[model samples]
Target: MSGTILDRILEKKKDEVRKLKEQFDAGNESKFQKIPFYDSFIHADKMNIIAEVKRASPSKGNINLDVNPAKQAKHYEASGANAISVLTDEPFFKGTLADLKAVRDVVGLPILCKDFIIDPIQIDAAKQAGANVILLIAAALDDEKLKSLYEYAYRQDLEVLLEVHNEEEMERALVLNPSVIGVNNRNLKTFEVDLGVTERLLSRFGKNHDRIFISESGIKTAKDVERVQKAGAKAILVGETLMLADDIQLTMNQLKVRLR
Candidate 1:
């Protein structure tokens, strides 16, 4: 079973890497020297919501590829998001470097380039594409690889958000000493979700880790936001729930209210 899991992950990564190269070669990367966004996010007053921009997911398929990246980013900024996350994977996600660059240009908020993020090629691509942050998933990377990638991100002036789903993976991410630690409520193995995952891990983090703890996934309504914030999550990453809202800004404002 473990072998099967490894094989599937490897295949997905191979495809993701191939797609990343295509985005790099597209010639629409950010023209600027990359702004310092980490400091901006660190100063936000409330839960640092990282609004994501993407076309689709492999699980859902085709989620607003036609949505204008800059327009969406403006809405996110107006709605009080601390950061933005752009999906640059073109295969399963149908996203590109243009999407990330678009968000970077239009918004003053810190931006996170969200993808599988397997290799250094993709890391450089992210920097060139104008991402201020990068995600490191513990399930997809070994300890050494995580350390290498996290260090690379930091060297480029990018903050690292290490994501994990379980106690064991949390242990792995803890070793990397990432700037931010995110506990994803969704289980990669079964796609199951429970906010308790964050609550459970809070015990292990203790009170003096200095890591900004974030909770991701299954966050739907203002009530969900309230519950997780009370559970000790400093921030939350919401995707589909906000994406599906009739008014994106209204939805974000509702969540912000709950955070207070």
Candidate 2:
């Protein structure tokens, strides 16, 4: 609690990882069939939406604490979401693995376990809880750990969404030759949001046809979607906006702009 927001969150994850290791079992089976997350963007002409099931955040406090994860996920799929991102972190995000399981039980779209994943046990736990994709932030792990986790998730048959914030992290992310890379607009350590983060990074790194580029966070309108899509993002990971929307379907439809 005394450290930076991300520092505190990672510290909490360490404790959670310890608890997960004690309960880890190799016999666990995934309840839902895995959907190819990266493929959804490849075949799409419209900007894909990775709708997030989030209750709260350390920066925003409580966004929608009473949200039903399963119901929200089903709504997303109906509204043309390409994938679902469930925040499985508890200390800061107020989300649990149970929320992910509930969402998985209802939707066939790829499910992304959006958490501060730092260990193999967390990946195993996410897989057991029915995650088709797991997020690996470049800012959180070193090159060695990042490559290890990226390979480990692939071996577990889970897709990795490698997240980067700036030029430095993007450089590190490219070394893994990730299939899906997301540029997070929010700085985890300071908790400041900026849409330019995605544009700047993509402009510098340029775009790739083989890999999917996603702009995550601070997206709220069609124009915002257009901006990132023009920056070479095939997909957008939206959380707070959808969680706080009065009309979830309409909001999602608006965000699903045609690819530029």
Which candidate should be chosen as best, given TM-score against the real structure?
2
Q: What's the residue-level lDDT of 193 in candidate 1?
A: 82
Clashing pairs in 1: none
> RMSD, each candidate, Å?
2.9, 1.2
Instruction: Give the clash total for candidate 2.
Output: 0
Q: Which stretches of candidate 2 lie over 4 Å from their true place?
A: none
* TM-score for all models, in order of appearance: 0.87, 0.97
Q: Report lDDT per candidate.
A: 0.76, 0.91
lDDT of 1: 0.76
* Candidate 2 lDDT by residue in tens digits, 65-160: 999999999998998889999999998899999999999999999999999999999998899999999999998899999999999999999999
User: Residue 41's C-alpha lDDT in candidate 2?
Assistant: 74
